[model samples]
Structure formats: C-alpha cells, structure tokens
Target: MRSAIHEFPDDLFTNNERKSGAVLLHITATLYMFLALAITCDEYFVTSLEKICEKLDLSEDVAGATFMAAGSSAPELFASVIGVFITHGDVGVGTIVGSAVFNILCIIGVCGIFAGQVVVLTWWAVFRDSSYYTLSVVALIAFIYDEKIVWWESLVLVIMYAGYILVMKFNSSMQRFFMGKSSKNVANGNAATSSEMEDVKPSKAYSRGSVVMVDEMMNASPSKFRFPEAGLRVMVTSHFGPKTRLRMASRLIITERQKLVQAANGVETQVIDGKVEIENGTVPEDKPTEAEENDTISPFHIPRGVGSKIKWLISWPLLLLLFFTVPNCAKPRWEKYFMLSFILSTVWIAVFSYLMVWMVTIIGYTLGIPDVIMGITFLAAGTSVPDCIASLIVARQGLGDMAVSNTIGSNVFDILVGLGVPWAMQTMCVNYGSEVMINSRGLVYSVVLLLGSVALTVLGIHINKWQLDFKLGVYVIVLYAVFLCFSIMIEYNVFTFVNLPMCMEE
Candidate 1:
C-alpha cells in the first residue's frame, strides 16, 4: 500500500531523480517525530494530565494508571491506528509488542544500573500490575495468533482495559483485600515514620538492607504530605503512587535548585525557623508559587551553562512551535483551560504518530526492511522514550514500585487501550464486522517473547528479593538485547521465513 505521506513513486529507491532527497526527508521526518513526541509528552500531555487530576479530584494511583498511562501511550495508540487503517500492515502491532518488551526489560535495566543504589520494590504493587499485564499480553497473543482480529476480539481487549481501569479505581480496596491489611493502619504508620525521618539527613547511598528499610518506611502507609502552594498535590492521600510523589519531590528540588542559582547571582535567602527560603518570589494567597507555575515549561527557558544552553537552543524551535499551538496548562494564564491543552496535545500526538508511521513504512520499503522489523526496532524505541525517562527518574528517587508499576502499567495500556481501541474502531465501527490482518507471523513470536520477557523480569526481581539494583539491571538489559536480536532474526528469516521480503522496484 502506498503511504499517504509519500511524495515519491513506489519508494525512495524507485525514483533516481530525488532518491537522495527523499531518503534524507524520510530520515528527518522520523527524527522530527521523536522530537515532536518528546515535546508534546513533556510540555503539554503530562501538564494537562495533572490539570485533569486536579479538576476531577482523582487519586494519584487512579490517575497514573489511567490518564497518565493513556497520555504517555498516545503515540503508540495513534501508530497502531495508522498501521491498521492506512498501512494495512503489522507495523503498529510490532511497535506495541516491541515497546512492551523495551518497557519491561530495557527501562528497568537502565533504572537498576543507574539508580545509584538498591531500590526495593513493593511486591504487591509489582505483582498486581504485572499479573494484569501478563493477562493483557496473553489476550493479545491469542487474538493475533491467527493473524486476524474480529469485532468481538477487539471488544474483548477494550473490555479488558475497562476492567483494568476499574481495578485501578479500587486499588486501595484491592490492596487491602489481597494484602489482608487496611489502608488506614498503613497510612497512620507511614505518617509517624515520615515525621520522624523528616529531621534525618538522607544517606549518600543505600545498601540492600538500607534499601529494604527505606522501602518499608516509605511503604508503611500512604503519605499525608501536600504541596498546597506548589499546586501539584490533591486532597487524596492513599491514592498517591510513587511516581506522583516523586514528581512532587522533584518540584521541591527544582525550586531549591532555582533558588541556589538565584543566590549565586546575588539573590538573598532567608532562614525562617531553620528552613531556607528565597526572597525573589512569594507565594500568593491562593495562587500557585513561581515554581508551580513553571513546573512544565521551566526547562524551556535558556539556562546558565554551555551544555544546557546548547540543548535549549536545539529545542527552541519545538518549544516555540508547541508554545503557540498548544495552551500551557501549567502557566497561570492557561491554568483553567487544561482540557483544551489536553485535546490539542492529543491531536498533535496523533499527527506526529501518523507522520512517524508513514515515514518508517516508506523508509523500510525503500531499504527492503520488513515493516515488522522497522516497527519492532525504530518505532518501538522512539515511542517508548517518555515512559523510559519517567521510570528512570522515579527509580532514581528510590520509588521502585512507582517506576516498576509505571513500566508494567503502561504496557497494559499499550496492549489493551493502545492497540485495542483502534482494532475496535476498525472492526466494530469503521467497517462493521471487518477483520484487521496481521501481516507477519513473526509478530506472534515477538509477542510471545514479550510475554516471556515479563515473566522473566518479574522472576528476576523476585529472585533478587524485589530489589532493583545493578545486577538485576544488567540481567534485564541483557534480556533486552537478546530479545531484540531474536526478534530481528525472526523477522529476517534466520529462524524461519515468517515475513515476506519487501517488494522493491527494479
């Protein structure tokens, strides 16, 4: 099928007159897609997500599992839509499958290796998310096994996601039901431990035992902390996930860091009741502080260092483009128009996703690469960067459960909502009773491998005593490398000819 975005006949290789230019354009298109996704996710998508959470008074756990997951997984969803409707191939499925593996193996691996110390995970949280994720993957494998998806199958996937959402909605209840403990007791214990630890200095590094201690202290109860002036926290306590809490902590750190920068340039700092406060900005009676207002777009500002300057300079065009096109919900001016920002960001994500798929399909065709292979490799990694970065950040903060749950939970969203919605639209609505075809048999193998990766990762974490550290990181990373190798080889017919050779013009 000819791509709607392709200007060249057949592919870049088919036309000598503009072959080189076409190739370069496609390459640039792919890179631009990455930049576009990153900008949209960071600046607009997540900020809008926070706004929705605040507006709806949703819990952090529910919001993170649903809105945050959906927001971050938007690109993959759109890519799957493009793959099914436009490309009529396996690219979308391949991307989702590959991305699932990457999320499970590669991201966790990186977090483990670079998190600076052992970070103990909450077993129940990991188990809950991973179990649901496994079922989702299994459902995907079952649906795609025969290389066709019918209306009912798509419906099943969508319904499965609905069930997952419901589970997240009652996460605390489920935790209590399964763990045999009420959240109130846990919450109370957490409050006492947190207050005691408030005066203690954070240790430089955590050993395995210290990691367990930290995990116990942190997981003892839901945090009652609120950043009222920062405007990130809600009234919800037990619902806060590690990711949400970590972001709040990051906001405070950023404020302190900003104050330090200001002090270096001669801004005065005041010590009030043994706490350091900057005099440059004051928290308004009801309005968010300067730090809260710039929470999302703070990095867009030109900073004081050469490397940071260069990075900001490179990102300036994207920043400017997004700034004009989408409302910045984090800004005081557009604070109330978060829904508008969410809609606009989602639209941009769809556009970027379409361009990404279109370019990758053409490039693969030109270079004689199978769509599945391109999808599994390039598209997967490109789309998953946001999740990877988020997981790594939280992991470094010693929010191992948050990091692990995010990775696994996003996979669930990707498999169920990301792929499911598109399939449902095609079969149930777009063309009634129609079936979407899976172009490559290799994708089934890849998905099975994806399931295996999840099992192995969970097993590895369990074996490591639920601690994410350097050894487990290396293990999962090696698993990721091995997965990529096997997937590529399978697509290339090294093990079996499951995919047809890309048709090329002479």
Candidate 2:
C-alpha cells in the first residue's frame, strides 16, 4: 500500500481518496477564509467604523489615519495576535513585513497601472507619510534585532504610533507650512506648463500620441469630461480630492441604479469603455430624491453568468452565516448601534484570522516550507486584500495622494499597532519580564529589504515627476518581484542559512 499524504509519507492507505479529501479541505478552507474576510471588512467593519468616527466627531484626517487604517488592517493585526499567543512564531511579524512591502510597492504599482489615467500626487503628503513610515520600519528593525522583544521595546512602538496620530491631527497646518512658500512658484510653473501644452496639438484622433494628449488634458482639467447625471453635472475638477469624487461617483452610481426602469422602458443605456452612456439626447426627469438616496439599503446583487453564479452559490453559506451573526449597521434600523456592529465584526475578524493562519501553517508544514515564508507570501497577500481594494478605488478616482498616503500610512499601522499590541500583551500581561522570541534571523534581512523598497518607490515616483502611470507602475512592480525573491531566498538559506528544517513525520 502507498500513502498519498505528502507530510505523512510513511503511512499506507488502500487508495488515494483520503489525500483527495485533504486537498479539497485545504482549498475549501482557504476560499471560505477569504470570503469571510471580504464580507466582514466591506459590509460590516468599514460601515461600523465610519459610524463610530461620526459618533466620536473625529476629524477626517484623524479618522483616516487611525480608525480607517485599523479597519483596513484588521486582518493583519488579528493574524499577528494569533501568531503571538497561539502559534508562538514569527508568522505575525513576517506577515506585517511582507504586507508593508506589498502595500508600498505592489499596491502603488497596481494603482499606477490600472488607474486608466495618469494622476499627479502631492509631494507633501507623500513625503510626510513616507518619512514617518521609514522611521517606523527602522524602529521595528532595531526592536527585533536580537530576535527578542522586551516589554519596553513594545511600549516604544505603541508610543510612536500615538505620535503618528498627533502628526495626522496637525497635518493641515504642517502641509500649509510646507507648501506656503512654494505656492506662488508652483502656480507660475503650472501656468507655463499649460501654455506649453496648448502649443502641442494632436496629429491624429486615434493615434497613441493623440490619446496621450487627451489624457494630459483630462489630467489637467477633468471638468471638460463632465457629464450630466441625475439632473446635475458632477464634475471631478482638478481642485477636488479623489475621495470627494469617489463619493460623488457612488451617488451617481446609486442614482443611476434608481433610473434603471427608464433604461428598460425606452432610453438606451450602454456601457461603453467602462462608462454608462445614454444614447438619448434628453435627460430623465424622474430621479431619486435626496431622501430616497439616504434611505437606500444595500441591495443583494446576484451576478450574471454561470461561473459567477457558481461562485455566488459557493459563497452563499458563509454570507448567510455572517448575515445572521453580525448586525448590518448600514441599515437605518441598526445604524444607531454601530458600536455593537464594530465589536461583532472584530470578533469575526479574529475568528477568520485564526482559521486562515491555521490553514496556512498546516499547508506550509505539509509542503516543508518555513512558517515565515508562508506568512511573507500567501498570508501577507491574502490579508492585505481589503487595503489593496481601497487603494485601487481611490487611485481610479484620480486621488493619487489619498491612495498613496493610504498605502504608506497603513504600513505604519501594521508595523506599530499590529505587532506592538500582541507583543505588549505577551510581555506585560501574559507574564511580566518575559520576552517574545523571533525564531528566524531571515526576517531582519526581509525588513531591511522592506526599507529599501520604500526608498526605491519614493525615488521612482519623484523621478517620474510624481505621476502614477504605466512606466512607474512597471518599475515598482519589478521592485516588488525582486523583494519577494530575495525574501524567499533569505528564508531558504539560499544566500545564508537562517531557518531550521521543518519536523517531518516518519
């Protein structure tokens, strides 16, 4: 008899049915974990967090810096907690390091590639976030240098985070001070640039050159592309932040959904190049009023196509479970009890994180891969999905600063809060005068690579004239690939042996 289990090779089985079943279980668990995280974050966690911010009357900058960063980073944080108390390994730290690299390089690379148009970033926001993030990374490296964390070192990380929050609180004044002196010079430079652009006309309508010219115009003055929607022409002008534009776009999308009956009746609505265009010259007078928009509850969308339907069917069980367990705070009835929603959503996040880490750990063990490698690659990427989605949405809306700031700022949160809270709990609460051990020395090298990735990314953006576009996208993506390769090699001792072989069953 031969056994099919990779980790338990000595066991004999009559057939491979058991192995097939095990593989199926792994796949099922992985998919369910991602589905649970996605639903919890998008529907419950984010909505409840927003309401909490409103209730607390936190400023937009503060909310974005603190709670919003936490909301997007909840999974990584929970994963770190599980790593500390449950697994007692470096998985949590590795995940944070990998996720930081992913957020800075991969997310920015994605934004630059898929944003559909070149978006200019404000230098002050980038510099502010990046400088603080670099310091956080340096602090993390210093704390973990000996592969052990004492109570005070963890406390330092927490205190540094508090300082970051204060910096965000005073962000406006700082930004003004930084830009005040150069404001006039920038204005004059912009005038010269626009005049220079005016002299360069497109030679052909359908040529690549012509498209670039049109993109430049759109980047310079988006108001020219404004179209009437819901009896109002909402223009995403140069002065408007991408966040504001995103809100307006969401309202337009909702209003358009209300007018779907008009499209069914006689008005032809076609989705052309990702834009909903009306064929009729006249606008529909019957639009959803402000009250109606305010009262709209989230609609359950049954996606079209056989493949999509199958996915939806598979995800239905998890969706139903969450719907019953967690209160939907976005609804008007449960809206007041957002705190409850936040707490419940958080509990679910922990549960899901535990399951995800457990599955990944088992998978790594079965494959003879180190826990740090698993954490750095699969676990890191999986847990960072929410942050990736949020950044991409803002990037597409032409809010490059918000998108870039979000990626960098979330790195700070992941490093300081995600890793700090757990270490603090273990050292201070779990047992006084105790230290948490980092089993792998490779992680230090990975963190160093993480710091370099940030510098390269910021330098790349600067060299590209602060434009998020195809070229910059390619550059940063290459850097991400190199980072992953080096980290994996470092863990495997390809360059230097830093990890022990996994224990195998004989």
Candidate 3:
C-alpha cells in the first residue's frame, strides 16, 4: 500500500510541520508555467496538423478525429503509463478513464458553447464514428468487468482500433465516390463542402471582413498566458504558417472555374448572338476579400491584450512565430516533420505532466490528503490540458465535426491504444506476474457514465436534425458534474455498488 513518495517523513522538504504559503506559491507558479508552455506547444501542434491535413488532402473530420485526436490525447496516454509505473493508486486506469470522461463531457461541451451551435456536416459520419466508439467502450467494459486485464482482452482492444481505421477509410472512399457522381451532385457536394469551411465571415472579430479587430479593454491583458494572438493566428495561418496571400492566390485560381459553375447553374448565364455569355447584369460573383481569405476566422475568440506583444518582442517576434510554421521558411513540406513536431509536443506535454503530478502531490502531502484522491481529481484533470487546447482550436476553426470528432477520437485512443497496447505487452511478456487492481465500484459507474454520455451526444445530434447546440453542451457539463460528485462519494465510502458481482457468478 505504501509508495516511495508516501514514505517521505512529514516536513521532509521543509522544517515547518505545517502547510506554508511558499508551497502554495511554488505549486501555483509551476502550474501556470506549465499552462503557458502547454498552450504554446498546442498552438504549434494544431498549426502543424492543420497543414498536414491540408497537404494530404484528407477529410478534416476523420483525419482530425483519428490522427490528430490520438496525437493531442498523447499527454493523457503517457501520463497514464507513467502513473502506473510510479505505483500511484489506479493511476493508469483512472487517468485514462477520467480523461475520456472529461473529453466527452468537458471538451465537447466547451466547443458547443463556444460556437453557440456546432453543426455536423454529415450525420452519417457522426453515426459511423459513434458506432465504432461504442463498440470499443463496450469491449473494454467487458474486459475490465473481471477487475483485471488479460493479454487477450488487451489484444482485442488494439485490434478494434485497427478496425476503426479501416472503417474510417471505407467511409472516406465512399464520400469521394459520392462526390464523383452526377454533375448536379458534384455542384451540391461543393455547396456542402462550403459549410465545412471555417470562414472569416462569421466571426465578430473581423466584423464582416473589413473592420480591423480593436481592443475593447484599453490595455489588452498581456500575460504570456493570455495568448490571444495565438487564437487570431489560427485564422491567418495553417500548419505551414501565414496563408493569407496563398489563400488569395488559390482563390483567384479557382475563381474562373467557379464562374463556369455559376453559369451552368444559371446564376449569371446569358445567350446572345447564338453564344453563351456572362452578363454583369446580374451582379458578378463576389470573391473573398484579402482579410476574409485567411482561414482562421471563426465565430468564437479568446481576447488578448497588446501586452502579449511583450512576449512576442522579447523572445520570438510575432512575425518570427508566423515564419516558424511556414514550410519553405523552416522545414520542408514533409509529412515526417509535422508528425515529428506532434510527437515531440506530446513528449513535452508528458514531461510537464510530471511537474503537474509532483506539484499536486506536494500540495496533497502538505494538506494531509490521500494520493488516490489527488490522482483522480487533480492529476487526471491536469493531464487533459492538451485535449482542452486542441479541441478548442479545431472547434474555433469551424471544423465542428473535427472538434467533436477529436473528443471521440481522443477518448477512443486513450482507452484502446493507451491502455490496450501497454497492458497487452505487459501481460503477454511472460514470467512477471500481475495483479492490477481498480476501484470496482467506481470503475463500473465510470463505464456506465462514459457510455451514457456518448449515447446522449449522438441522440442529441439526431434529435436536433444533426446539429449540436448550447443546450446539449449544458446537459453534458451537468452530467459530468453529477458523475464527479458520485465518484467522489464512492471513493469516500459514502456510496458502494460494483459490476464485478455478475462476473463473479460467471
């Protein structure tokens, strides 16, 4: 029951036997520092992934959901692995399960509230993803119902993840096939695609693309932590960096083609002298303005003051930050680099996670609190910071599907690959025996809560004509809060019921 960390004598780190403001300050400062680093790395991560998605010509929703989702959730994954290694109470399983629950309920909920309404471009995609995710969760629950993980069960989860990829591939191929249907269908498809594009027009910051966004709070809160500029950059840049000029150029190239399509649709087509023509009579098609051409403009925004410029001024200038992602300016447009940056960022997140855990432990020790409680509440939540950042960026970019998908994607990756692969290797590797214990009562309820949240989200989209709105967001957040309360109670022995009984009889 004892861990090395727990063996340290009281006042080992300090002479005083009582909690001190110094400890509080150390914890507070470290957490914020970690937050700043995490937020910055997250900016670069999303930037790189967006470029990768664009270059590969992949569906933002599917790509973001699976690849980017797994990438962003990397922090929680590593944290869980390490948590178990450190012999923290149920750290591995608790973090993954808790993080999954947090993603579905908190991250998705936040995205919904931000957009006011997060619409699904294809409810079919939603259903398709939901089905696989539900399958994975059910399988995991079945495996863990025995209060232990076995080699075969872990293998099944890993296999299930591979299947998820195959299914996604099939779905993407079908979408492409449909796009290549009749000419009429092709035009319709383009129209549908436009809905998925995160345009600058909808956001209040640009104010219909002409108004320069001005600061409302005179001095602009400039804390390095308040990286408003980072959010703004999401509009003007991609993973490759500042694409304003490139987008305009690309738009010009597509303009002539768009004109022909308009003529086919009879929007401005005319016949004179036995020849077809475009008449300026019916106003010419309006092209996106220079400001609007930037991709990062979304309906939601995080405010920043000019003070952040101090951060830009001292270390790396804003322009330098812009150039950092530019493919030509820095690295070549290789998939490996984007992938590498993502991998490194996850590692960075993992390193910061140790800091977070250590700080939380110190705080708990000072307060004479239990390790299990701290692991579940503080450490579990801390490790999910990347998911919080990545999903918000995706959502703000108007890829509502990707934003929501990432939540599902992250949870799926967390449960299956995160827990699965590690356990698979551990259990299958011979002579080393194991007795991995989980809180039976809490584990059962967590699975139920997870399944219910996923089902409710899918049903809400179905009921609202495949649209996600603030009401659903509110519901999920409330659901998560209730679940948290029940979990705390169960942990404290105030409530008790577990799913192992059914397995016991079997």
Q: What local lDDT score does residue 91 receive in model 3, on the 0 to 100 scale?
A: 53
Q: What is the TM-score (0 to 1) of candidate 2?
A: 0.78
lDDT of 1 at 87: 76
The worst-scoring run of ten residues by lDDT in candidate 3 lies at: 183-192
Model 1 Cα RMSD, 1 decimal: 6.0
Q: TM-score each candidate.
A: 0.83, 0.78, 0.63
User: Ranking by TM-score, best first?
Assistant: 1, 2, 3
lDDT of 2 by residue, 177-261 (tens): 7776333222111111223333433232322322222233334433422223221222222122222223333444444444453
Per-residue lDDT tens digits for candidate 1, residues 164-189, read: 87887787677767766432222111
Candidate 2 lDDT (Cα, whole model)? 0.70
> Largest TM-score belongs to which candidate?
1
Worst 10 residues of 1 by lDDT: 185-194
Model 2 pairs in collision: none
Better of 1 and 3 by lDDT: 1
